[model samples]
Target chain A: MTAPVDVSLIVIVVVITALVFDFTNGFHDTANAMATSIATGALRPKVAVLIAGVLNVVGAFLSVEVARTISSGLVDEARISPVVIFAGLIGAIIWNLLTWLLGLPSSSSHALFGGLIGATVVAAGLGAVHFGAVLSKVILPAIVSPVLAGIIALTATYLAYRTTARADSGTVTKGFKAGQIGSASMVALAHGTSDAQKTMGIITLTLITAGVLSPDSGPPFWVILSAGLAIGLGTYLGGWRIIRTLGKRVSEIETPQGFAAEASTTAVILTSSHLGLALSTTQVATGAIFGAGSGRRLAAVRWSVARQMVVAWILTLPAAAAVGAVAAWVASAGTVGIVLVAVVAIALAAGIYAVSRRRPVTADNVNDVGDDAAVAHEPAVPAR
Target chain B: MTIDWASLGLVSVVSLAAGVAVVVLVSFALVGLSARVRPRPGGAEDGAPTLSAGAGTAIAAVCLAAVVAIVGFGLYVIVS
Candidate 1:
C-alpha cells in the first residue's frame, strides 16, 4: 500500500495534468463550433469564440452522465494508479499540441482514451481495460457518428439549396446567416457538455485511485467547475490554426452551407452526448463541412485537405497510446521518474510553441488562405 | 458486452431527421419572405416589383416559429 502523503501528492499532480489536458481539448475543438460561423462572416472570430466559451461553461453544468461513463466505464479503476492517469494525460497533451501545431483537427477524445488505455495496459496489463466497453462505446461510435453526420448534412444542404434556389439571393443569404448564429451556438454548448466531462471523469478516477473518493462516485462539484472553466478559458483563446483549416481549407462555405453544417453537427453531437457516446466533435464538424461542400457540387469539396485530415484522425489513437505507454513505463520507476517525464514533456511543448511562433496563426490572420498554395489554387474561393 | 444497438439507432435517426427538418424549415422561411415581391398590376416605374405584404409574411413567421421550437427542444434535452 502506498503512504498517504505520497498518494495525496500524486493525486494533486494527476489532477493538475488532467486540467491541462482539458485546456488543450478546449482550444483544439473550438473550431468545431465556430469555424463555420467565422468562415461565412456570420460572426466575427473574436465574438464567436467568446460566445462559444460562455456557452461551454453553461453546457458543462447541464450533464454529468458522460463524466460518469469516463470515471468507471472505460477501465477497471481498482487495478490502475493515479500515476498511470498522469502519464496518460501527458500522452494526450503532447498529441494535442502536435496536432494543433500542424493545424490538424484530430480527435482529442480519442487521444485521451488511447492515453488512458495505453497507460493502464502498461501499468496493470491489458485485462485492466474493459475491451467490451471500448469496442461498443468508443470504437463503434467513432466509426458511425461522423458518417452519420456527413450524410445528414449532405441531405440538409441539398434541400436548403433546392428550396431557396428561386428566392432572392440577398435575402436567402441574410436569413441563413441569422440561422447560422443559433445553430453554431448549439454546437458550442453540446461540445462543452460532451468534452468537458472527459476531464472530469479522469480526475474523478484519479481521486478514486488515490483513495480520496469512493469507487463509482460521480465527479465532485469542484472537479466539474474547474474542468468547465479550464476548457472555457482555452476556447476563448481560440485555436486559430485549426479554425483556418476547417473554416476555409476544407470548403468555401456560403451562409446556407455553414448553417446546414452547424445545425447537423449540433444535432448529432447533442444526441450522442445524451446517449453517452464520447465522440470527436472535430470529426463531426469536418464531416458536416465536407457534406455541405459535396452536396452543392462534388468537385467543390477539397478532397486533398479532407484526405489529410482523415490521415490525422487515423493516427491520433495509436500515436497518443504509444506516448502514453512510454510515459507510464518511465513513471512507474518512481517519483524521480515522474518528474523526469514531466520535465521532458514541458520542454517538448515549449519547443513546439517556439516553432509555431514562426508562422503564427491568430484570429486576425485565420482566414488568410492565400499563403497555402494547395488551398489557394482551389476554385472555391478566389485567392486574394 | 452487447452493443446498445437500439440507442445507436435512435441517435442516428433523431439527429438525421432533426438536422434535415431544421434546414428545410429555415429555407422555406427564407423562400416565403424573399418571394413576396409580385409584379404590380401595371408595370412598376423602375421595373422593380412591389412587395405584397400578405400571406408570405404569415407563412414565413410560421416556419421561423417551427425552427425556434426545435431549438428549444434541443435545449430541453441538454437540461433534462
Candidate 2:
C-alpha cells in the first residue's frame, strides 16, 4: 500500500463506497425516526424529513467515540487491505438497496458489520477475526437492544393511556401531538450521533489500511463532513416505502402511541450509546413501534407485517456476509477485482432502483388506505 | 469472553426508567392543563370537577419543566 499507487485509488473508492452506504443507511432508516411523526400528522411528510435531515448533520459532528471502536476494536485492522474494505462496502450497499426496494426496514448496522467481518475472514484468516468482540459487541447487543426497547415502549404506552383516560380525548390528542414533535426530534438527533459514526469508522479504517493515516487515528474532518452530508441528503429524500410499512402497515398509530414509541426510541438509543454500546437504531425503533402498537390492543396490529420485519432482521447478517465473502474472494485478484466488484454493485443497485419505480411509493401515496397498501404486501415479487 | 450481561442490564433498567418518567410526566401535564379550561356548554368535561387556574398552571408548569430537564439530560448524553 505504501509503494503501489493503485492502493490509494482503491482507498478512494472505498471511501466513496462507504459514503454511498451511509446514504442508503440514511434513507433506509428515515422510517425509524420520522415514520410515527408522519403517520400521526404530528408533522407533514416533507417537514418531518427536513427536520430530521438537519438534526442528523448536527448530530454527526457531535461525537467520534463510536468511530474509533468500529475502526479498531471489531477486527484485526492491520491485516485487512483497502480492497477488502471496498468489497465489504459493496456487499452492504447491495443489501441495503435490496431491502429498501422491498420496503423492509432492516438493520443497516448489522449489514455493515457483517460485510466487514465476512471480508476480513476471507482476506485474512479465521484467527484475524476477533470472535469475542463480535459476540459481545455485535451478536449480544442485537438480541438485547430491541427487546429492551420494546419493553420500555410497552410500559410507556400503557402508562400514557391509563393516565390520560379521564382527560378530554381531543385534549389528549393535542398534548401528545405536541409531545411527539419533541420525542421524534430527539430520536432523529440521536440517530445522527449514532449511525453517522459507523460510516466514519469504516472510512477511518480504510485510511489506516491504505497507510494514509497512522494506526488508531480517528476520522479526519473531511471524512466526517462527507458522511454527515451524504446521510442528511438521503434523509431529506425520505424512504417513503419503508415509512409506510412501519407507520401505516404495522399499526394505525395514534398521537399517544407515536409519542411513546419515539420517546422510548430516544431513551434506549441514547442510553445504550452513552454506555459504550452502539446498538442498531433501526431495531430499537422497530421494536418500540411494535410494542406501542401492541400496548393498546393485539387485534389492531398487523402481526404478519411485524413477522416479516423480524425475518428480515434475522437474514440481514448472513445474507450480507455471503455476498461480502464472494466479493472478497474476487477482489483478492488485485485492481481488476476491485473494479469488477464496483461495476457489478452499481449495475445491481441501478436494477433495484428501476424495479422500485414500477410501483412507486412517494410521500403523496405514503399514507393511503391501509387495506391494500403497495409496500411489500403487493402479492407479486419481480426478481429484484 | 463472557457476555457483559451487567452492562446490558443497566441499559435496560435506565432506559425503561427514563422513558416511563417522561411519558408519565407529560401525561400529567396534559391532564392538569385540560382541567383549567372552562367547560363549554354541552362539553364532555361539564360534569367533571375543574381545578383552579393557579393549581392547574402550577402543575402543568412543574410537570413540563421536568420533562424538559429529562430531555436536556438526553442531549447531554449524546453530545458529551
Candidate 3:
C-alpha cells in the first residue's frame, strides 16, 4: 500500500477534480433547459439561469441514491485506482471545455463515461472493461434517446399548431409563451436532480477506490453539499456560447415552437427516468428543438449546423477516450505524475477560456448569433 | 447485455401521451379563452363571439385544470 499521506492527498485532489468536472457539467448543460425559453423571449437569460441553478441545488438534496456504483457495471471498480479516476476526470474536463469553446452541445455524461472506459482499459487492460454494457448503456442511448425525443417533439409541435390554428395569432403566441415558462422550469428542476447526482456519484466512487469509503456506501452529506453547490454555481455562470448555438443557430424558434420543444424534452426525460433509461439532456433538448423546427418549417432548419452537432456527438466518445488514454499513462507514473497532469489540464482550460473571450456572448445578446459563429459553422445562416 | 427494449418502448408511449396531452390541453384552453375576448374593432381577430362568456371561461378552466393535474402527476412520478 502507498504511504498514508499519499493516499489522503490523492483523495483530496480527486475530490476537488471531481467537483470541478461537476461544475463544468452544470454550465455546459444550462442550454438544455433554458435555451428555448430564452430564444423566444419567454424568460430573460439571467432569470432563466437563476431558476435552473436554484432548482439544481434543490434537486441534488432530494435524492441520495447509490452513487458509489456509477461505473460499476460499465467497468471493474475493484481494479480502478484513484489516479486512474483522476486521469479520467482530466480527460472529461478537457473535452467539456473544448466542446464548450466550439459552442457545441455534446454529452457531458458520455464524456465522463468514455474517459473512465479509456483510463480503465489502460490501467487494468481490456478484460476489465464491459463492452456489452458500453453498447447497451452508452452508445445505444446516445443514438436512440434523441430520435425518440425528436419524434415526440415533431408530433407535439404539429398538434400544437393545428389546434391553435384558428385562434387569434396574438393570443396563441401569448398563451404558449406562458406555457414555455412552466415547461422550461420543469426541465431545469429535473436537470438539477439527475446531473448533480452524477457528480455526487463520482465523488463517492473516488472515495471508494481510494480506500476512504467502502463499496456500496452512499454519498455523505459533505459530498452531496459540495457537489450541489459546485453544480449550482456553474449553472448560474451559464454556458452562453452553447446557448447561442442551441437557441439561435438551431432554428428560428417562435414562442409556440419553444413551448413544444421544452414540453417534449421534459416529457422524454421524465419518462426515461421513471423507466430506468438514462439519457443525455443535451442530446434530448437538441433533438426536441430539431423536431420542433422541422415540424413548423423544414426550410427554417439549418442542415449545416445540424451536421456539425452530429459530428460533435459522434466524436465525443472517441476523442475523450483518446485523451483519457494519454492521461492514464502519465498519471500511472505515481503521485507526482497526477500533479503534473492537473497543472497542464488547468493551463489548457485557461487557454480555452482566453480564446472564448475574443467574441463573448453574454445574457444581453445571447439570442443573436454572431456572424463569425454562423459563417464558420454554417455559411447559409445569415446574420440575425 | 440486452437493451431495455421494454422500458424504451414504454418511455416512448408515455412521453408521447404526456407531451401531446399537455400541448393539446393548452391549445384548447387558449381557444376556449379566446372566445371570451371583447373583439375590438382594430383587433386582428375581430368577430362575433363564438360562445357565451360563461361557457368559454368554463371550458378554459376545465382544460387548464386538467393540464395542472397532469403536471402535478408528473412531479409525483419524478419524486418517487
Give lDDT per model, in order. Answer: 0.89, 0.87, 0.84
Model 1 / residue A49 / CA error / Å: 0.8
In model 3, the clashing pairs are none
Ranking under DockQ, best-scoring first? 2, 3, 1
Pick the lDDT winner. 1
Q: Where does model 3 sit among the CAPRI classes?
A: medium
Q: Which lDDT value does model 1 have at A332? A: 97
Which residue pairs collide, candidate 1?
A: none
Q: Which digits, one per residue and each the tens of the lDDT, describe model 2 over residues A1-384?
A: 133354567777888999999999999999999999999999999999999998899889988868887888778988988878887888888899999999899999999988887888899978888889989998889988888888888889889989988776777899999999999899989999899999999998988887877888888888889999989888889999899888988887888989999999999999888877868999999999988887666565677887888899999988898888889999999889878888889899999999999989998989874456543453322211
Stretches of candidate 2 exceeding 4 Å from the true structure: A1-7, A369-384, B40-44
Task: Give each prediction's DockQ, rounded to 2 decimals.
Answer: 0.62, 0.78, 0.69
Clashing pairs in 2: none
Candidate 1 i-RMS = 2.4
Every candidate's TM-score, chain A alone: 0.96, 0.94, 0.94
lDDT accuracy of residue A34 in candidate 1: 96
Model 1 lDDT tens row, A287-341:
9999988878777788888888889988888889899999999999999989999
Per-residue alpha-carbon lDDT of model 3 for B1-80, expressed as tens digits?
88877877888899889988898899888888877766667666566447777887898899999999989988876777
lDDT of 3 at A340: 85
Task: Estimate the TM-score for candidate 2.
Answer: 0.95
Better of 1 and 3 by DockQ: 3
